[model samples]
Target: MTATRVCALSELEQDSAIRVEVEGVAMAVVLDSAGEVHAIGDVCTHGDISLAEGFVDGDTLECWAHGSAFSLRTGQPLNLPAYEPVPVFAVTIDGDDVLIDPAVKKAV
Candidate 1:
């Protein structure tokens, strides 16, 4: 797996998501309600918009384009318009830096 340092842990807010690029893959960095950092694919399954450009509430990340909400832990879509799952990558916090494994795919 290819791991890349995206950003610092302090840069993210709780219950919000940020759009980033890991290598060539578009990725999303989410901070849940518990303030844990999660990495997932940024694209929406039903649309071409990036998921990071959306909003986050609790553990769910909602796409601003069409209101497709996805679980941060499982990457499962919770709402309509998106039946297929989006890919979610694994994220690790190394001290202060946010490290991500882009190869792992999950529905986010």
Candidate 2:
């Protein structure tokens, strides 16, 4: 499958995350503090809470419901209550557009 255009790069604020869905897969598109874009599964592995609503600190996204921080680059859970790693998708930036492929899980 080809990468789907999620949103414009300009639409994302630095150090923030946006919720998007690609091919029925919920995703959290994050712009880290260093201005790098990352795509991870939106749902927390420990619960049904949305990771998009979590806090972005450096390269990790902290789940708001259980304070479980997941690495934005690898989707590995960094704290308790979540022992499993979330899926990290491939993210590509083309011009001003942000593209993501839910079918492709990025290598950790």
**TM-score for all predictions?**
0.91, 0.98
* Winning model by lDDT: 2
Q: Score each candidate by Cα lDDT.
A: 0.84, 0.95
lDDT of 1 by residue, 32-104 (tens): 8887888877888889989998998888789999999987887789989997777777787889999987886
Per-residue error (Å), model 1, residue 48: 0.4
Measured on C-alpha atoms, candidate 2 has an lDDT of 0.95
Worst 10 residues of 2 by lDDT: 99-108
For model 1, give the RMSD to the true fold.
1.9
Instruction: Put down candidate 2 lDDT per residue, 4-87, tens digits, no spaces.
Output: 999999999998899999989999999999999999999999999999999999999999988999999899999899999999
